[model samples]
Target: MVRTPQPGTHSSTDHDPDTPQYEAGAGGWGSLRGVARIFAEARSSPEALRILAGQNKPKGMMCTSCAWAKPAKPHTFEFCENGAKATLWELDQRRADAEFWQSHTLSELRRLHDHDLEKAGRLTDPLRYDPESDRYLPVSWDEAYDEIGRELRALDPTEAVFYSCGHAGLEAAFLFALFARAMGHQNLPQSSNMCHETTSVNLLKYLGSPVGTCTLEDFDHCDAIFFFGQNTGSSSPRFLHVLKDVVDRGGRIVTFNPLRERGLVEFVDPQNLSQMATGRSTPISEEYYQVRPGGDVAVMAGLMKCVLAAEDAGPGTVLDHDFIATETTGYAEAEAAVRAMDWADIEHHSGLTREMIEQAGRIYLSSNRVIGIYGMGLTQHVNGWLNLGMLCNLLLMRGNVGKLGAGVSPVRGHSNVQGQRTVGVGEKSAHMPADKLRELFGIEPPTDDGLNAVHACEALLEGRMKALVTLGGNLVRALPDRTRMEAAWPRLRLTVNIATKPNRSHLVPGQVAYLLPCLGRTDRDVQETGAQAVSMEDSLSNIYGSIGPAKPPGDNVRSEVAIVAGIAKATLPRNPNLRWDDWTADYGRIRDLIAEMFPDDFADFNARMFQPGGFYRGNSARDRVWKTESGRAEFTTPTTLTALGETPDGQDVMTLITLRSNDQFNTTIYGFSDRLRGLEGDRDILLINRDEMSRLGLDEGQPVSLVCAIDDGHERRVDDLKVTPYDIPAGCVGGYYPELNPLVPLGYHERNSQTPAYRGTPVRVVP
Candidate 1:
């Protein structure tokens, strides 16, 4: 959750150009040093430290936000910039109780910006808004749960939706799924559907797996890496250090991206003493290729053709000829298509030269083992599934799958975002078979197909969805079509949010709205059994236990697990098969159930997760042990060469890509400034190309409204956007999502994954 403080309640500065670079008596940089001091003081303060240490299940447990705790070793800096943001955000000293909500009406709170609303701080109790009084009144835990149960019981289960964000713990998610199933509803919308659903959906189809095959530590063992649209330095700094080691050891990196971000070219590793002290930066990419917005298929096909040619020539080549023939299918036809294409045409469409393409192939050919890394940049395209398949083809051609250092790695955002889906938090349960969820849970779960994120928004707009229970997410703001959502939010019968801090979602409340606050990841989860530990799955499908340090907000406030358990108990009192025994008492039982559900992977979840470092779920895809019917990995061929789109005549079409700033994560707005882009204190600025700006007769800072060019005839427009001309690519413009979400129609999504096409939406930028 975003924790933007209110005016004067917390310390912050305007975009002052004349601020000092360094503060007197401080040992480091200006605002950073000041922030460091405050963080230290917060750690040392008696009450704060008591809340952090005593409330901790295992007293003195380290924070879960970052790698700050000393692991029996000494370190210079205690936290990273983003880690500090997470720590401060969780440990903020503000409180929003019944009285606070009593004074602020829902309509009045709507007038407040997202930043100011978060300033009200952690919710101290569960609240239900009274439309007559125009304020949210405090409700007891029993009453709150009972009211939600009543609503669920009253409605046709299919009309209600249970939406969740990535931050929810595994136990909470499991319990939510159970409750939803008990009620016979399947409208589970999660954060993963927006981000990595393409990778998950396609990988499951191609490799019979939904996760990355390679681990983070495998970057050290790679000889070459093909980074498909991932900005390691800016997006995930830890990847930067790994890339540095790869570069230092004469490893080659070939980047395939439209925008040539500086972070990819040269990044100064703060972990390196010599580099940081001398301000020397390491070069990450040996060669870079800027692929066209929707031309990833051609770029990958071209690379595959090179490997195929080498294999046909002789035995000594990058690809193992026997393995290609025996293991892979469709190589002949794929090669024929690749060979049929002209180099000049490939270069023309991809916006990359043949020389660069050959250089990338050479990098792959020279390396004994390779790892392919990608992010949303690769998965947000119209042909995202085909792009994923293309990457899989490249890996399969060289027998990269199941190798020690060579595999596919997709860097995921939103901590525990992957976990939510792993534990049956999807529209359809992962634990469910064809008929029902009866085999696993002993009761028939919903057989009705569930609504994903996109479907949920459309359902709300069409007034098909009556009730919404957001476990944790800024749904309206995080989703597209914000303007339509603003109007649609009031149509719901009940809107319940189980959140940590205030965001734009809370502003759009229903007639009988409730804000059920819960504990953060860094806070202790206490229950009758004792200090409880919540489990989470990492990006690499590794499940681990997170024992928070700080105390939960108040006595009235509860852990997410407790809230779900309470709701379940209220809703399922008559069911004999149901068990709420360990629901709120402990989280270990939930882990046991998860282990039961996935015996092959998590055989002993309780023992394995208790280790200092987490354990990994053995990825069969890494070993080429496909879980498909054939028991072998299948080669998928693309039906279409490129993504087909209808561009209106004289519209001057371009791909509108949505992005997150270096300072933010998901939809959580931590800071207004994007320091890397050289924009300070401005979230409203769009990064446009200078050359394109000149050709279009536009200035550097021109405010423009963007309208999406959809073939569906749905009107979507985001007006009053500030455009800043920069080093972006021609026929491409970038803007922050959720903010510019008003321009994207909810139905404008990828074909297979159904994930919103935020990256490659066809739109025209007018002056």
Candidate 2:
């Protein structure tokens, strides 16, 4: 039974008595602990120190962890806690050489968790899966490419899928998407499809462009910052300083999230020695509202409704009438929709009292310059697309767009994920600017739309998709529906992973599974043009060059560009028109091609990137230039809030929001401890509200089974999870992912964006 979005479902959290909470704010001593862990992992190697010194500097390596833009000035320690871990993890001296692989069998390795697999260290060579022995044996690059080319040529392009993670270098991702396009297939789906796809989808629908309208500079000028379902501190630690600066300048922040994130409550600057020494912390959020899971759309509605009510009292009281009339469309319809929403329904859906909603509205009304910030918490929902659309509507109502300290901001994860999308990685259904590809490549791109992650999973399971080639991500591990995706893996005829560290995905055998290890972001990527650099686009759309100081983890490790080009050069017709060799030889030539493709944005791409921090790619929305269909910012008038909820069925049903541990980034885990969250040693614990525990006849440390309530006609269950009392919204339960990913259904995604509802999954806890 696929459940409809409704009110009975509620999100919750939990905590344990033994593990003391991380109340000492972000950074400070916490970062020192992270550095210590990294030092231990790298064994205090000089190469590790060199990589650390180069991190986040003007000419330093990009932190492969998050997409937070670099600050104008470099502090003595520029990297954050997680950034330290990522740096050390990338520079890890451990090697899973041929000897290591020879010692471990697939059956034995499969027992290890995802983190253990990564801890096995960098793959030393290309590995081919041998089913008879059930182990991945070493294979030469030439043999791997030859086999991949033969397989690619044999299969119809439509039957194959190209998947990439955010960390793949710009040139590599460009060639990756181009390879798909040139092969006459639109089956290229990257990380965004499963995470921030809603941000792009709704932003594109409203403002013509999907990129953020404001830069980090706006953080300095904003009078007030409104947070919706985002914990900037743990996710993007660099942004914590921006929040602190906002408060230091007398700016107020309002947060709406189910869980009470430490960063939103208070923060201690790691750089401020006095404060660090004194143990004093700076409080961040002026007001915090524990909204229910999946309630972002309703909260936005309530806020807009309050704005409209104030508008009704005085024609232009809260609404920016001048800006509304001049810069937006469908205002009347959207206004009516807001007016039509009942106050009781708003209260019910938003999990907030009318007074609270009005209070938040008053703050918005008083602010001269306001900013809205959100993350996967808002976007990974059944109605995530509407959630973003409503956010855009709320911001536009106050004329928040195109001004200092005011805009709709989606804090994307991964360093270069946005760059991957910018370089045209997407299903042909939308997002990809295909005309540019045809014009630049002089090849006919596939006209028909292709499959995204979820759709591709279905295609693979249903025998429609036969082959899979991934550039950087652990596709099987990163995606939803572990039960089905596990089943879908064997259905593929061939699977190729261009990676650095081996993961569980490699162990999931295909008829032909090949692991081609590539140089990581921490490694210096040298090509025929001497030591080379790769360009990355930050969350703020800042395009910059990143050059690392360390050598490749293994001699067999190749550059991403080389691997991508090698596969393409071997697979395609002899001397194809696209010329894979030229781009592979000189990345500058690749930039030249990109400049030709995205002339307005990437013009003089190579020369501009030579500068310390690259320039902004420029968003038309920033200048009130709407690229939308109506030539103005469009407004969507949704009829009702999402009906996504589940009722207690004999057993109490809780809205389960799966989150990453502080020790993890995406699927990469540094260790078991989540120091920021007071969690350690294990990832199997469930977080439930203390008050809700009492109401539901549950207690701290009580073991229970989590069963997917929205059956989707599938059996998804994780048994014997010990519940911990946590500081979160009542009626919601929390668990770490991808442990809880099996609870999420493939069909459970926003219609507009197709982002899996990881934040609003319905599950019942049974004794």
Candidate 3:
């Protein structure tokens, strides 16, 4: 698939900036330099080194950098560069003590970039934002909890909101979810509401589960793998090993993305000595299609159409009939829809010729073992739900669900976000079915669905939510429309955040703000039960033990579990039967309760965790045991790809997609350097196709401003961005998120999943 481009543009402003240039090849020396950068910034503290060495070990802390699970026997040094950076950032020697906060005014802190604030070091004590002084001061844990409890109890329960960060252990997530429910509030928002939430809500609707059905071991047997929107090299460094092994086994890898991620083109497995020693990188994607930003549906649908056409030309040529007859439904209708789909529209919207999709179809028809893997790129769109549904339909056609090496895989981002969902981090009903929750907790939790990240922001703005309590995460920086979110936050009467380090959220206060410092994943928790270990579920549903080595940050700081428990116990004095103290004393008790609540999934939860790789939460989709509406894997028809939203007369708009840089992880910025992209010093660089840049009369390093082209009431603009020519699609441009998040409107999100559509945003680029 190819689109003709205009001539390359050049102007006097094209003079090269002082930005550090990156080169091809993702690993080898680049990976080593990343580790060196971590050491240089953190001064290579002993605790950081010791803690990092134990990362991803059999009985060590789970790496929070990515949710990708480890093998049964982890290697000696399994930590990736990003994990090292995260460790250095978390285990910083400098402390955000009372003295630091005393010297820095809230106004001064607000002026500092989010990255500088993170590098200032860990929050060493509980801090309360004193509105009168416009500064934060240390507050006793009891006083902070009491003030928060009073506000929570006084407000109408429905007017309070709880935001969860799934990077925390499952125990913390479970306790927070329970605490919110016990307080009679179901409007609990979570990190999953923004990131891979479509995988949870949509997979449940069609496949009967939200988690990936395939195990990591499936990589050994799969013959062909298709990747959509996942750049494993930078996001999940360890996963590059899997891709290389697949290629070595003669397995084909096809990628569908707007730009050619260097990882997908060639990768040097840092773990592989021969490749790293000789500076040899393996070619990954055999056929790469630059599908339009919002055109995943059209591409997949066109492939499905090709499959149906082949089936029509020769019966039993492409599809599995026996599996369809007994194991699935909706085949006849879905087939008819695909047969009638217009190829011209598919090619137009997808920016791919029919030949490209047919080649993918032929690979699918021939391969007996195939796995389709996708990431937020597909789900962070208006059609996120349908995108997943269409992938399910494609997998079901081949009876791939319960097969040896074939199933659906939506690679999640956070370490235990999946487990957080499994342990009931969403609305209370998600924890236990109505009867089960009543039977287990002896209290009926709210039955109604709660607001996601987007809706929760809306509630805060509209004065529908008065109190905000976050388990962790900088929700304001993570959310869209910071100018508006910063304004909306003050509408809330109370705000409480439990975090490992101080972020911009703590500084941007509500009327009463409490920053309750908590232990990091690499910090030890000494409870009444002696030392404790928390469990986390990874991308493949493997629940493993994560034990931290470093001691708690300070004498006053509490474990996330304890902090959450303390607040809940203080607020609910009426519920005498609830044993918050007992749960805090022994986390194993909480596991027992979890097992009791989810008998089939968590049977022998405590005992099975003793095994090397922990246990797998059961998925009906994996076993082909249909819990879906039709008693079979139902087929879903995807909608036609719509053209970019119309602009005003004489307006030239380009589709914009916000992505993460190599130096960043989610909202946290390690530094300005993005070595993977050959960028440094500045993150405001906008990636544009060479032809498109010239058409707009823009040149490399040319200063530009971006404004939302839509006629939305929200006036979003990010200024002083430099344009960089890159190998992206013709009508598309790219910029890093959190920096460009201001351009995204809260209302512009996937309707079904409520996941903010970070791509396909129409924008006017001013030079």
Greater-lDDT candidate between 1 and 3: 3
The top-ranked prediction according to lDDT is 2
Candidate with more favorable, higher lDDT: 2 or 3 = 2
How would you encode candidate 2's per-residue C-alpha lDDT over 1-767 as one tens digit per residue?
22222332332222334334786777778768877986797665877777777688777888898998886576777788888888888777889878888898988988998887888888778889888888788898899999999999999999999999999878888888888878779898889988998887788888888878879789889999899888776788888888898999999899888777777888889889888999799988877887888777788888998887787788866778899999999999988888888877877777777777788888888898999898999889877777888888999998999987899888989899999888878886344466776566667778898888888988987899988999888777778888789877987889998888888788887898888889988887777777878888988888888887887877888899999999987788763568877787788888888888778889999888846556888999998999999999988887667535343353366788898888888888788888777777888888876767787788788888898877556888888899887766665789998888888888888778788888988888887
Per-model TM-score, in order, reads 0.90, 0.96, 0.95
Error of 1 at 452 (Å): 1.3
The global C-alpha lDDT for each of the candidates, from Candidate 1 onward, is 0.70, 0.82, 0.79
Sorted by lDDT, highest first, which candidate order results? Answer: 2, 3, 1
Against the true structure, candidate 3 reaches a TM-score of: 0.95
Model 1: how far residue 710 lies from native, Å: 1.8
Instruction: Please provide, for model 3 over 30-98, each residue's C-alpha lDDT reduced to its tens digit, 9 standing for 90 to 100.
Output: 887888887788665677777877788767888877888778776667778777777777777777888
| Model 2, TM vs. native | 0.96
lDDT score, residue 528, model 3? 94
- List, residue by residue over 507-546, the lDDT tens digit for candidate 1: 7778768889898876777788999888777676666676
- Shift of residue 481 alpha carbon in model 3, Å: 2.3
